[model samples]
Target: MYRTILVPLDGSGNANKALDIAAHLARANHARLYLLHVPVITEKNDDSLVTSPSQNDAAMQLIQTALETIDVSDLDTSILVRKGTPAEVIEREAHRLDADAIIMGYKGLGRTSNEKGGSVSAAVNHRAACRVVTVR
Candidate 1:
């Protein structure tokens, strides 16, 4: 029933599960899978920018690793790495991409990682205009 599905990965177990689920849904519905990663910026550069080469590389690698674990040969997929609050970037990308569904991890690498639904996923679940499925 979904035309475009967005799956945000954070290198977490839940995120990996979400990717697997999203892949199945995409294959079933012939939907486009959008993989997004918002890297955790541990330090800022001299220009006070939150983004760095290492951060970008890590984000790309995370997505690549996730993609490799799944069979995406027949899937239309795109990978994106953005710099912003995880929830906000996900929400914005969902809207910008005109996604029909978002399947993401229930928890991420946040202070509330032990919680059932972490802040970013909870926020996206509430803010996304499309259907949101949070995988634990």
Candidate 2:
């Protein structure tokens, strides 16, 4: 039933697993995929400065690497790299793109949660306008 699918990746193994699922679903539903990578910038409470330029560069490289790992030769796909909170950016893009659903990985790199989904996944699932599928 999905037409436009949003896939948020963090360049982690878990995000790649979710990419596989999103790709399959896109193929089955004849849907287009929107790939989003958010380079989060964490700062000290003083908020004196944003993340270093080097950190942003590394995040961009990770996003490019993630793109290389996927084969979108047979699917309609779009890639975006943004700077913000992962969950907020994903949700905003989903609405902006009018995505029918969001497919994302539940596990995260350094965050932990008692729930199966990570903090970002859980937040997006709760705040998104459409359905959210979190792959473990």
TM-score of each: 0.88, 0.80
The TM-score measured for candidate 2 stands at 0.80
The residue pairs that clash in candidate 2, if any, are: none
- In candidate 2, what are the lDDT values of residues 78-108, reduced to their tens digit? 8787766678788999999999999888876
- Cα-based RMSD of the predictions, in order? 3.1, 3.5
Q: Model 1 TM-score?
A: 0.88
- Give the runs in model 2 whose Cα sits over 4 Å from its true position: 42-57, 112-118
Top candidate, metric TM-score: 1
Q: Residue 65 lDDT in model 1?
A: 87
Query: How well is each residue in 27-135 modelled by candidate 1, as lDDT tens digits?
Result: 9999999999988767767755398888899889988888788778789999999887778889999999999999998887665321345588888887899999988
Candidate 2 global CA lDDT score: 0.82
